[model samples]
Target: MTAAHAPISAEPRRADFERWRRRSRLIRTLRVVLPAVIVLIFLGLIGSVAWSTFNAQPRAAQVGDEPIRLISPRFVGRDDKGRAFVLTAESAIRDRLDYQRVILKKPALVLDENGPDQMRINGADGVFHEQSGKLELSNGVRMEDAENAFTTAASLFDTKTGEVVGSGPIQGAGGLGEIQAQSYGVYGKGETMVFKGGVRTRLETKK
Candidate 1:
């Protein structure tokens, strides 16, 4: 007869099966809980980002009364006689106190545009009175045309009449030759020109 076989115990196998069931239950619970926790965290982050994005917008600024500013300004209108004229400036500003007055920098005025008697006057600084059609030219006033060129310390120009009057010293060169005077007046496209107060002329003739 063979040696008596040792008996196998079922307790060890049963314990192993019980441990496997417990582990399977724990794994299923964790699978569901982990994804739910991750989705909740993701949703919280999305909500926070959306809230911050909506709150980060710009606000409107304050407005002011003088809102107009210009560069290379140009003005075109008819004179009193219905002739055309133009005024240009490197910069211009309307007077806050007087709307009719305009301050000009490096101002240039062209009279009788494209006509036989075209004239141009310019200055470093000027004040144009729009209603009266008077321009106060100062700081190196200069006047020019086809035949004449004049310069003075200061002058007054009437755009309507095409007249330039200067009480300060005026010097110029023209068909009559180089002339100097304490004061001068030129009317309407130089149809008439007069000089007074220590007037002097030099004949510049080229042979």
Candidate 2:
């Protein structure tokens, strides 16, 4: 009975020792591997942030603050008498010093377009005053309507009141005749033409 009991007890003791050894070996391997994996993941995160920061520097440096430019600009408005007018230009450049002032190239203006008395004016260069609704045209300005056409050196036109005035030499040809004068004013939607300053007229005979 003692010999049988010894073998049974020894077998159970051996099995318990084997189980403890396997568990200890597994614990040791996990302890070393877990710390190594955690260090690798932390390094990967740091490297990603460093790469992103390096690539962003050039794009940040390339931005600029510059003045605005316009192409083929158009402005439309109504006059005091509810007459429509349109101001168009080949190109317009905004003034850097004054935001409301625009420098126009090949500026063209059309007034009372939908009405029976329409007027058109063209200039080589112009300056628009936004607040006053004033247009200053220069460099061979030409103005025309249904009955008359005139060329002047310079003119100031008020878009709101539909009033035009020029103080320089002007030459004109129209239904009445050809006239050359030093100054002129057009009012009442061009129903009236007043010329001043050394006025000369050549009337055409209507046969």
Candidate 3:
């Protein structure tokens, strides 16, 4: 006859089943939470990038009161009467406030009006008015041609009328002789020049 065996208890098996069920639930919850966490991180990164871009500063543009300068400038034009004239300067600067005027350095002016004589003028500095066709020269002004030479402190030339006038002490030497005058005027397209106000002259004798 076989000996009878004792039956095993079910309590240990039931406890193992419960532990496995809990572990399965924990794994399922973790799977759902991990995807949500990844989505949130991606959204946060995208928002941060967008915000930085919106707040970014723009690049600055390059941008002054400097006057316009010209090197070796020449102006040639005809007067209202269709007479031609030429003005040249070693250098010139446009006036900051006056658009129709220019400051000239080492200026030389030549006027030809289809006349018997041409007028030439030189000055250390001058102002040329474009609208009025006038030139005001100062600082050792000199006028010369085939017949006469004059030196004065200042002179004004009117291109429209073909006239030159100066006020101040003038010393001139020409075919007539040496002359000293308080003022002088040249008109008739530079054909006639007159000296007035304390005029004195010394004639040169021909050999």
Candidate 4:
């Protein structure tokens, strides 16, 4: 009896081994690349959401639906003798229902070419209703008395005696005096402007 031996081909074995190695490399490459792609997609989605949430907004000035507007306005306060003692800027917004009523009470004073003493504030925008007889001005408050000018964010002036009292920045110039006050109380019933708290006054004359 005789046995037959099979011949081995190294070329076939090498080809098969090369094919298997290529497939294995492809699978391993996918394992690393697929997770990296998924992580990038997740981060992109999160970034898009955060950007939309923060940037989506609008700035607003007025809160409600109202149709009232005012241009440059001026005001004047008079004394019992019919002489102008105080002058102020007049600007405000009000409901239509209360517009005429408000205007009639606190008329804006007309300014003379000369200055405060000869000025008249008779045009009205609103009235002061408090029993304490205080006048209030908001939104660009400016007051001019003779050579003096005082401006503030807002103010409370005494309707009875033309005095100012409140907490706000005030600047005034007149009668050889320059005043800057953080808070002030003006008693025009007297003859001088009084500055309170961090008051800086430059006097040009004593008399």
Candidate 5:
């Protein structure tokens, strides 16, 4: 014969059931609320980034009447025939009247660096017109190529037409000899030059 089994208490089992129910409810609530909190944080970060971008100012907008300064400003472009040209300035300032124009200090221009008509120009100061493709140089302008050298008080360059014209007196020296004129002009990408207005030339004779 087997001994009688003790009766199991229902109270303990009921308590265990209640505790399991509470734990399950807490896990479900966290599953829903945790994702919501994460989404809100992500949206806040995105909004902050957008606000900062909208309030930022551009480089050009910051310029004022005090003259924007640039160091070693350079411009590179091609002519009508696809010939490369370069313009560089030690320093540059934006024009007060027109924002599209720039004033360059100690500017240098190079045209067709590897071509037969390669030329280099230097000037104390220059004005560059962006829309018109015009460049004006002053304060003792000088130019040189493989065969000739020129000096002028002022000069103008037209990038569109590849022409360089003088505004004041000019002096030149080449294989032929010394030349002086009231005005001068260069065309054909520095292959041809013309001197005008009271021209004086002295050609050297071979001994």
Candidate 6:
């Protein structure tokens, strides 16, 4: 009877001790794992931010709120008869991406008119620049105005003066005559053309 009474009292103490041991283990595990989880999350956030900074693309500069760019080869203008004028390139590159463009090469220009009226213009080996109101053709260039039925050479154009002046040799034919000169100047809106230096003209006679 005495042994049985002692065993019953020890059973409750053993159960209480087991419960306390489990609680202690749970607290210890949370204390160790919570800090480890927080550190891992902090490291992950740092790595993500660093990757975004290093791999990001730089922003392109803009001109007047409009991005500075070069246009691709395209039909930009029309002739008097409402025909299309196209730019023909030996090799053309077009990029509309993000409204930022870059172009290269001498592009030939073709007029909309037919036969002798159809013209082709090509610039010398150099970069062609397009400005606000006009196109600047430079570097040993040639223009075949088929409408006028002539091939002329020129370096610059003055829109106000309506003139084209050649920096080198120019040879061409018009409705009035055939011309050859060391330098040539043509009134863009008028028929008055002046050829200088070894100028020669062959007039077309009426039959």
| Count of backbone collisions in candidate 5 | 0
TM-score on alpha carbons, each prediction: 0.65, 0.68, 0.65, 0.41, 0.67, 0.46
lDDT of each: 0.86, 0.91, 0.86, 0.58, 0.88, 0.57
| Candidate 4 off by > 4 Å | 1-127, 130-133, 204-207
lDDT-better candidate, 3 vs 4 = 3
lDDT of 5 at 139: 92
Clashing pairs in 1: none
Q: How much is 14 displaced in model 5, in angstroms?
A: 84
**Clashes in model 6: which pairs?**
116-146, 117-147, 162-188
The residue-by-residue lDDT of candidate 5 on 72-165, one tens digit each, is 9998887775677899999999877788899999999988888877888889999999888888999989989898998999999887777899
In candidate 4, what are the lDDT values of residues 158-193, reduced to their tens digit? 655655565888776767788888886656443456
**lDDT score at residue 129, model 5, on the 0-100 scale:** 93
Q: List the residue pairs that clash in candidate 5.
A: none
As a whole number from 0 to 100, the lDDT of residue 185 in candidate 1 is 94
The C-alpha stretches of model 6 lying farther than 4 A from their native spots are: 1-37, 58-72, 79-85, 93-104, 115-119, 124-133, 145-154, 157-163, 166-184, 195-207
Worst 10 residues of 6 by lDDT: 125-134
Put down candidate 3 lDDT per residue, 51-111, tens digits, no spaces.
8776663322111235689999999986555668899999999886787899999999887
For residues 1-207, could you state the per-residue lDDT of candidate 1 as single tens digits? 889988999999999999999999999999999999999999999999987777653221223346355688898877666667899999888886788898999999888878877888999999889899898989999998888999999889888777889899999898879999999998755768899999999998877
Clashing pairs in 2: none
Top-scoring candidate (lDDT): 2
Clashing residue pairs in all predictions, respectively, total: 0, 0, 0, 10, 0, 3
Q: Higher TM-score: candidate 3 or 6? A: 3
State the weakest 10-residue window (summed lDDT) of model 3: 57-66
